[model samples]
Target: MSLRVQQMLGYTLLSAAFFIGFFHRFAPATFAEPIARTFDVGSTALGGLASMQFWVYTLMQIPAGVIVDRYGIRVPASVGTALVGIGAAVLALAPSFALAMCGPALVGFGMSIVFVSVMKNNAIWFTGQRFGFITGCTLLTAAMGSIASEAPAALLLRISAWQPIFLALSVLSLILAALLASFWRPPPAEDCGQLTARNKKERTKIFGTIRSVIARPQIWLIMLAISGTNGTFYAFAGLWGTPLLVHSFGFERDTAALAMTLSLVPYGLGSLFLGQISDKLRTRKAFIIAASGASTVAWVWLVSAGSATPVVAWICFVLLGLSSSQVVASFAAVKESVPDEATGTALSLVNMGVFLTTAIVQFGYGWLVASAGTGSTITGDLYRIALWLPAAISIAGLLGALKVSETFPREQHQNQPANTQMAIRGQLQPPYRDGD
Candidate 1:
């Protein structure tokens, strides 16, 4: 096959894996009632079950990044995809709650590697200018999976039990894993020769590279910004949004899911366009700051609009998803903030912030809701109190956006042939110069 064909096939398969990861990520929210009924668990336990995935995913980010940096995408991506399949099958057959918990944890561990692999592949197969757009497309694809897990999955639940659905997911994931292993090819050596060489040379100093990535203030700021915006979105749309709507606003389950779908649809669409716009504008920080500000405003509106009408709630959800969609820009910013060789590490670090905050918010929200009461006893006022957590985090994200350095224009200007040669030889510092 031609290189272009190979790139297309490889990226497609990787995206398929990413899609499955996203489906599982949000599936619990759609099936929260059924899962709770099956296990006779309360809000806190369900939250813990869902948060299990984020916790494991959070812990695995650095290791996943290191493995991707060292071995490239093929072996790790294939194995990780298979693990997700196994986890789903485990969830399908689990005889008890504890065993079922293991399923999400395994899925989390498996999924932790997929995003870094996709981002690393994008860096290798595409040029720098298109990176933001490609990342946006990747997220757009992920949003489809999120959508599938929500409204469609809820509609399916009317006719079938959740177990059979997960079994089908398990089979699909396994097949995708097999295809990824068989057909996913790397970019041509000429395209990635320097990156491969750098990986080899840095293998012995992996810890040093990680430390350097961690030491960068820009990376930390990007992490805070993303954690606040995307983290809040995930905690809600991925798990709590539907429940809040159904229990608090008196919407039916399917209608609540449809509302979540509305949020995700815009989120996906916004990711696609906002990424392209960020690239065209040749700016990252501006979009990040704007997104953070918007997210903060949406949270405030949602919290203050007590017992909001369905239409008002829908507007807030849409705003939340759209504002958070600028997360694609944040990932691009992280990639641009570090050296090309350390891209995976930097991306992983920022990604860790997202899941870490997500896990906390998911668990914390559950704890807050559970503390107030249980099933049907939980009130809109209680949900409102829990929401302030994410709202405060969004404010922190806005602050981080303000502090993060502008990277796109500076990196574009510095990545000339001579600068590339210098970068390859480790003669230049990272492109994060102040006042760029």
Candidate 2:
């Protein structure tokens, strides 16, 4: 195949890997009842089972970034895809819930690197202008996976059991992994992030690189902002959104699934829409600020609108989805702030917040709901209490957007140093132009 064709195929295969991970990430939401039944567990136990993915995923973030940086994307991405397939298969065939929890944990370990790898590859393969747009497009694609996990997945459960569905997903993941392994060969060793240092030296280099990234004050802000805004949204969308609908508005499982799916539609569109708009306008803070503020408003409205009507809830979900799109801005913002060499590390740092928060809140929120002592028939008051959390956290996004330095750094060809691209274990590159 031609180079362009190869790139396209590589991108597509990676996208498939991402889709599987995304689907599996949220699969537990719809599978809650069946999995609980099969495993003989209640809400607290079930939350632990489901949040296992995020916990392992959170633990793997820095390591994933380091590995991708030291080894590059192709092999890690392939391994990740295979691991997801293996995890899915484990989940499909497992006889017990405790055993099944191992599946998502393994899957999380595998998929932890995917988002960083994709971002790293994009930095190498595409221009800065195209990066934001492509990132949005990828999220749009993953949102499809999210939708599949909800409505279509709920539809599939009607025909066959959840075990069969995940079994099929396992086969699909392996197929994609094989394709990624065979078809994708990146450029020479020099252009990629994979390092060549000896064991002791490489270890020193790895820690140093991460240290530099952590040393930056703004990374924490970006992490907090994203954790609060987009990160919080992800927390809800992955686990709580469907149940909230079911309990609060008296929707059935299928109807709640559909509503959750509809809620995700705007997030996909928002990612694509905000990415293009931010790229075109050459601005990040404004879009992020607007998105964060708007998402908070929309989510709070959702709390009150619980009694208004389902249509109002749907509209709020859509609005929240659109606002959540500003998350791409955080990725873009962090990427621009740091040097190219640390791109994977920086992006992973922020990405870590999303899943870490999800894991923490997911496990915690389950009990929070259970503690209301309502037992299954959870009230609107409980729903409001649960749903209000993400809204409060999202304020961090607005604050981080303001505090982080503006690096109109998308025009990567401009002030970026050639030596910096060629340098590793070196001081960070200057991202700004010669100005005030």
Best by lDDT: 1
Model 2, position 318: C-alpha lDDT score: 77
**TM-score per candidate, in order?**
0.94, 0.90
lDDT of 1 by residue, 1-436 (tens): 9999999898998988899899999988888889899989986788888889899999999999999888888888988898899999998899999999999998999998888888998888877789889989999999999999998998899999999999988898889889888988887667776766777788777888888888878889999999888999999999999877877667787788899988999889999999999999989999999999989998888788786787887888899999879888998888777777788988988999999998888888878887877756877778877788899999999888889888673345555788764642334665445334
Q: TM-score of predicted model 1?
A: 0.94
In model 1, the clashing pairs are none
Residue-pair clashes, model 2: 1
Clashing pairs in 2: 70-194
lDDT of 2 by residue, 142-258 (tens): 888888898888788789888989999999999988988898766444443343223224544788779978987767877876776666667777888777777776677677778
Listed per model in order, the count of residue pairs whose N, CA or C atoms clash below 3 Å is 0, 1
lDDT of 2 at 183: 86
